[model samples]
Target: MSAARLASASAATAHQRQWFADLHQEVAAGGDLALVNADAPQEIFRAMGIPYVVNQWWSSIVTAKRRAQDYLGLLRERGYPDDSEQYSSIPLASAFDPDPANAPWGGLPRPTIVLAETTGDASRKIFDIWDTQPGVSFYPLESAAENDVPARWWELMPRDWERAVGSDRLDLMTGELEGLIRFLEQTTGRVFSETRFAEVMDLVNEQQEWNRRTRDLIARARPCPLPVNDSIPSVMIPQWHRGTTWARDAARAFHDEVAERVSTGAAVCSEERARLMWIGRGLWFDLDFYRRFEQSHGAVFVWSMYLAIAADGYLRYGGDPLRALAARFAAFSDQLYTPPWSAEWYVKEARHHGVDGVVHLVSEDARGSYFTTRALEAAGIPVLELHADNVDARSADGDALTRTVGDWLDRRVRAGD
Candidate 1:
């Protein structure tokens, strides 16, 4: 590693340790919250002394097999050692195959959550799990896009709205939040006000804005090497989901850091690097394999899915919680689950950004199976369809994925030569 490469790695390691300790202390101090997405909430819990683990974060590490000093370090820092000899060839190899319908790992704390963006019957699936457990709770943020929700909430489309909100759970989904506000006010001697609500909204908006700026930074980090650039996703994912002003600051620092790194032409220690973009949900486990493509075929992964969403998906709700959240969820089906999403458009955009190939981490039981691989292939991009659950480790077909990826690389490597 060059001095710069080595410094980036060392700085990342130091940041990883200090940040984890900082967050753990934050979690040790608890606060009541209505969770959204199993991720953001669990991040709070993990920080607040609540037992939590990101299966996505964990799976990424185990697949990587990178030398982690401690297990908690792996949990806190997103990089895992990518030591799996089998996953050396794929674009972004995942070690996990998740069943999104349930917690990918057994023994997860009972969830309290709101589903904002996901594939298939995501709301129903998450609600069912929460319903079966006690002491764990949740509420729904209406399903819609951030920019479009205020116009059509309370008037959901018949084509998909009714199914998305059924009779049995609709009341629970819609009413629980209002109920919680009232309950907290009455029981805890807490005074609820529009001002307080606005405060929360402000916090959320700040998070969204920062996330957007982060993605914009990465997309600009074009042709940057993988390992050096990988820190962006690892840091941003944890920061956005968890509530930590310090973490947010760290993220901002990261954006400026990457911009500086890219401007300076710093990258992981590699000579020939093929830049690729990852689409769809992150393959929680196979993160290392993704990095290996940089070394194996000289291909550097430039992007993953959620980092971009945080940048683009969050809405600035201002003072209207329902309208803002509803807007975020409104497009979930379209962008991820439902059809008519421009897979072709995104792939073309990636190609324009100079992507050499694409990887779609297909999870088990995720409903949108109709989105074909040909969209990117048609755009003159080689698509690698790796079968793996994005969350759960048990479902991953490591051997099959390894073999298929090897085959894909054989073609790409030979063609490049």
Candidate 2:
């Protein structure tokens, strides 16, 4: 490419990164809230009138592909890409910036409690000070907590502001459904009946069916034997935030659409961008730090985090209400925790997704990361570990991360030496 054109491209990438930086700063105004997932809605929070974002379908899709382009294409096709001043990223998908200080959208939230699939010890420390403290958070489907649930049930159980988080402990459950029904009915003044119950049952069933179908896609999602950048978003978005029906449908929708996009020959990315997969929470403080590697090394990140769950996880919930709920949680723990299983599962996913290498983020509050990291290395896939918070943007040193990632990619993906 000519120097002028190269300079122009650099300028564009810089503009995009700056826009994201502004978006991050602008959104921080809202404060925070308790984050939840499909299987574990915060009944108490809802009851107490605290708001939370369910990350069911969204989480799955982001992890589906091996590149950032895959995600970007999925969004553009879906008509939700970044434009002028708008962002279609997960955090802002459901809501937007106004004056985040007063609302939950733009600004973070007070007590931004989040529901993760499974958090490791270090990751937990990261979550405590970051995801939970300001707010209380838990994993609705944290099946590992099963032995204790019957005794404790799910409650705020505040020890210190960040105690539970520091220990990487998660408050997981399907939520207090029995109590939630009463709360919602009272709050919305809408009467729920067997018919309504059945509707919910139907919703859950649709979710599971979609999940079954999407996994079929995940198995074959990597057509290139090397995943493309545009594919990850469509796969992850829907599955990460599955509780809401709309979230699930959108993810599944992105998959078929992306395939057609390929068939129709849409530009996958501007320069055949060599892609990479990020296997961990997003570094909230340094999204650009994450992307800066592109400019420093001429690589366009095609994928990272959330979006695939939207595509697949949505399928496990749709049958017999209680039965579907149990099945979904059963499926989550069946895969996420328990080292041998989780590590093996991701290996298959990595091979199937076809990435050149893997970058795993190990947080202070996160547990079980070593197992996953080890498994990938044993499988012969190049992997890099970066320690930082996925949410606490405040914790990351963008310049340092950028340098490390640039060197890794130069040798691993670009030079292929």
Candidate 3:
């Protein structure tokens, strides 16, 4: 039997559905909306009262609804590469979904403006396509390279952000943020307020702090009180709404729920024998896969980047809220996907969670997966690498992947036992 779902996770999912429905209605009634990348500075939009939808979050919804292929095919029919950066490109293709009524969520309303950071060639090309649409204007930000490599970034990011992100990099991002503010002000005819932005920043920090507390609670709980499937929605839905009081309270409530579960010795798998860490984006198409091993091999996936990154990646505590916000995104991808930084954090989390093994789903678009595997192995934690797209399900064979993991667990993870 599957473990009972967390009440917090259920509530978060319900709230997201209602929120999206309201956004859809508002857009239908002639309200403007922004479609932004996951790494874009969303708090600015929040403070300005501009309703925005994250490209990645929407892509996940499309994938979950099994409409990813239909949209991706729309790209191929138009001579666009169907396989490149599917996570970022899927939603763009959905715009051409011949029948809007058949599209997921009644189709993402035609965005008035689209925002993205030019993180790579394919993503730039994808967002550029959005700009060509009649009513959509695209604004791209330059992704600055990380000049200074820091160690234990999570330790320094909250307060010592200047050192965590470097002064020069922060300057570039801060300037770009100012330009973005100007563009929004001109486009929406609403003045930007520094005081309001600072308040939004504070709420985001509070939300992340509660996430940190919950992560620590889960890490120290031996039996793993909450499943990774449950934790993903409970933490990430609120994360998308990071600058709101409701988001902050939702995070705290999740923490308290986990605390209660841990105190009561609640376990996702009562026969839990091996703890595993999932080291990539979620398999939105097959979340049930996380639970498949629990019944057969007694392996419960205890960690994912969703809650862990929220805990460690989003906090910035300095006087200048704009620069602090800039610091948050300046090297955001670097700290998560680059060597040394990602490798170090994965090892730290593996050790802290006491994971017996790791199932690292290495997406084609992500970097440094091999380094992460090497680091975990060096730390004496076995890793099973599975190459698959987290958002695109067309190429993945669920049965084959399951058998591969089952065999690996028997040979490598549970071998000594």
Candidate 4:
């Protein structure tokens, strides 16, 4: 049976749509806009009153609208590799989509400044191409390697962040953030207010606190009150707007809604025989894939990295908001995609949620997927690894994937039940 959609998710979606439309109009009226990577320090933008659209967020919108293939094809025609980091490359390709009328949401407005971290060789090159466009400047932040591996990082991340993320990495990132502020101040002719930045950081921490409570509430609920599809949008839309009171309130509303559902003994699947976790980027092209197994296998995907990371990954409680923000992102990639850290957190979350099985989507661009799989299996949880691109639909075979996962549930997951 289909689960009731969360009202908070619907409201967040509607707000985002209106917000984007207004942003597009403002930019079209000659206002400057920044296009930043998902990992970039968006709080700085929020505090400075600069409008920015996250590259990955827009890429998901383009992919979900069935426009990824056309944009990806444009990349191939221009001698760029179509197979390179599709999540970042899709928006770059969309910039050249000649027909604005056919573009998703009338296409992303030409950004005045593009900001991204040099996460890898391919992603750096992708952002570099954006710089080549007229009136667009690209700023790259250095991604430092994680030297100190901490156990149970989520526990220490909120208050004891200096020890959780090594001091050396934090220092480097703090310097990078300072440089970014200087650059933005020069480009936009807008002053960077330390007071405003601190306020934004406080709001973001508050938003995540509500998310943490909601996550714990859902984990303890039987039969799962919310599906991953609903949770992803509910958490992520507000997450993109993190550092604002609106986002903070939206997060609390989501928590209250989930808490209410749990109190009422609501269930996504009436006969949920299996509680499963989805590891890796969302299946943006086919969200329906999440619900395919609900009827036959009585399995509902209750966990995804979207809400879990929002709960555990973004909190930093310290006096120095700038340094705390730096600490939050210093090894952000490592905490989610590195060996021991990624593996440990996955095992912890799997146990916390009482997950019986995991479907890990091993994307080509993401690192350390195998370690997460091994850790979950070591914890006595079965895992089904699906190798595919999260945003690119051309690489996914939906029907085949459905059959494969169905067979897996029958053989590996529900068989034990």
Q: What is the lDDT of residue 144 in candidate 2?
A: 53
lDDT of 4 by residue, 341-364 (tens): 989999999999998899999887
User: With candidate 3 superimposed using the best TM-score fit, by how many Å does residue 106's alpha carbon deviate from the native?
Assistant: 1.9
Candidate 4 lDDT score relative to the true structure: 0.90
Indicate the residue-level lDDT of 278 in model 2: 74
Candidate 4, after superposition: displacement of residue 210 in Å? 0.4
lDDT by residue (1-417, candidate 2, tens digit) is 111112222333344345335545543665334556444533233334344544533322222222223433443554653221111133332232334343222233333445444333433332343333323433322435332221111111111212211222222232434444454455435454645455544554455455445444434432321132333333333333334455446544554554454454443233434546577655443444544554455454334434333333323323335333333344344244446545765676666556677888876545578998888889887888997755433345767777788788887767754
Backbone clash numbers for all candidates listed: 35, 103, 0, 0
TM-score of each candidate structure, all chains considered together: 0.64, 0.56, 0.98, 0.98
Candidate 2 off by > 4 Å? 1-39, 42-194, 204-245, 267-275, 289-305, 311-314, 317-319, 330-334, 412-417
lDDT of each: 0.46, 0.44, 0.90, 0.90
The candidate, 1 or 2, that scores higher on lDDT is: 1
In model 4, the clashing pairs are none
Error of 2 at 93 (Å): 21
Q: What is the C-alpha RMSD of each candidate to the true structure, in Å?
A: 9.7, 12.9, 1.2, 1.1
Model 1 ranges with Cα > 4 A deviation: 1-129, 132-134, 138-180, 183-192, 225-229, 232-244, 317-322, 342-345, 397-400, 412-416
| TM-score of model 2 (CA atoms) | 0.56
Q: Between the candidate structures 1 and 3, which one is better when assessed by TM-score?
A: 3
Candidate 3 Cα deviation (angstroms), residue 77 = 1.1
lDDT of 1 by residue, 234-302 (tens): 454444344445545555665666667667776654464566666656554555566565556766667
List ranges where model 3 is wrong by over 4 Å: 1-3
